[model samples]
Target: MKRLLFIIALFVVPAFALEIQNLRVVPKNIDAGNVTRIMFKLSGPAKLSINVKGLNGASVTSLISNVLYPAGQFSIPWKTPKKIESGYYIPVITAVDQISGESVTKQIETRTAKMISLPFTTSDLPGGNKEISYSIDKAALVSIRVGINNGPMYKIISNWELTQPGAYSVKWDGWDGDHVIKVDQLANYLIDIKYIPVEIDALYVTNPKNISKKTIVPASEILRQINAFVPKYSVAVSNKKIASNSKNNESINLDINVDDNTLEELGDIPYEYVLYIDGKRYGEIENTTSPYNWEISTKNLSKGSHVFTLMICTSIEQINTRSFKVTL
Candidate 1:
């Protein structure tokens, strides 16, 4: 009878309910150039999308577009913004059952931790009013002190000056302990930054070329109202082109003479490669192990095209993409 009860218990029961649980943001204090993973468990098959939003209700990166999946554990990886200002953010997870349409929304608070550190190496000449510049990733309370080379200790120039998130210079009118001094008296500079994370949602990250930027919140909405004493330049954007920073761009050469752009294979074991043309995903190269190659036809494309991207993805996390200006 005990054996019979044990066998009956072995026949497990499955949950019919559809929902996502145990959602979490790994290493909540994000850093520069790190991958942030969103993890969760599903009770049933569903479609889900994950996103990060600034505290001001502005949507950051849409990490995962809506996709269907089976009931299981999942951890989706996303490349965190390289120059994200230290602030409060939220990871939003939304899921919907494929059959029943039942859905659930979950959120977890995440933030960028702050630290006191030396500024990047700088050398500036002293004038009538000397300006000392520093580049910071976020808004910080700055304290500037100046000292002479082989002379006296550092003296306080400015204390607790709230500055914006970009590279701004602090001006010093050659003062020594609340008294006027000559510009030649200045020799060395010591600066310290104190970070206090903000609960802002909306901001823009712009690149130098303004191409491939990420906006946690749109600029128009965030600038609608300016509260009293808020740091004007607390948020910043970057101008990074997506094509130049790929690690898996190494390609194999081929002897064949073809007009179409040919893609190279992995190696002895031809790993499956997926291609993207004009920002849209095409099919994948099936299983095989050889010096395989493929090309895309540009005959049907418009003439004198300016800019587009050719990207290739593999099973690994690193992706390769090339941007070009074609005149066809």
Candidate 2:
């Protein structure tokens, strides 16, 4: 009869347990001057503290400190600091259940999507060839268009091409898409380059063991915010030295200038200029100084109406094209 005896065990679950839900960072990507919202929901009453931490487990910024709240939803706005490094950051939330004295923590990672640094450089090759190069911090869809300044795009070097992080070089033969004519001949050879970063999913790292794996965001996420972060530029030439008419054997000075507001916003960023006369390359220069001057002589040119195209590009590859017409 003793062999027939049985034993039973029972497990209980807490009815008022505290839990954090729907943790997220609104506008997951932002610049140093913008504000992003940190939002989450609470299942029960708890004492909460929120702060941002880097992947190296260092505190970046503190948002809240041991505040009591009823079970509901809450939001906190954090303004990115100018001194903050552009990279991945995590928002950590610590909660202590008021009834059960239980503690739980959650971390949702975010990224600073600002255009940090662009060290653009170019290399000249034989036979009037060029190697245009630049480096990027993150993966992006890059586009490079070629055309005359203030004219239609005649060639597409890259149309929203997916590129990885690193330096890349592109060869330019100075010709249109079909190689029918040199780009300089049509107008100022304008290389319009733009970059839009791929969207990265916010990682929710609740456990310490998974922190490393999740911190490195996968590059396969779908693209979002395509038009949100694109920068615009406007270019112009000074009329002080621009002449509407010139004799066939006379020399004329053309003063080129970019918008003052745009130059001021892009402080210390280097700029490159390429000038072209009707069907010919005139000159190309790189400098930080604005209102560059170019002296053109009509001594050897055919006496008639001519088109002058000027292309302006920043280190980050923001391009603006302007055209000037004159009769000789």
Task: Give the candidate number with the greatest lDDT.
Answer: 2
**Model 2 regions more than 4 Å off:** 1-197, 200-232, 238-241, 244-249, 315-318
Which parts of model 1 have CA positions greater than 4 angstroms off? 1-15, 109-328
- Name the lDDT value of residue 20 in candidate 1: 76
Q: What local lDDT does model 1 show for residue 105?
A: 84
Against the true structure, whose TM-score is highest? Answer: 2
**Residue-by-residue lDDT tens digits, candidate 2, 1-328:** 4434422222344477688988988877666557788889999999999988764467888888999989999888888776565555578899999888899898763233433333456677999987878877675556677786765444567645545567788898877654545775553656777665544344222222222211322221223222232334556666557863545448777777777887875566567887667645777787646766666777766778776766676554435555556677
Q: Cα deviation in Å at residue 61, candidate 1? A: 0.8
**152-267, model 1: which lDDT tens digit per residue?**
22235544343446776666666544242332354453333343332332222322333321223322223334331211111011112222222233221111111122222232
Candidate 2 overall Cα lDDT vs. reference? 0.64
TM-score of 1: 0.32
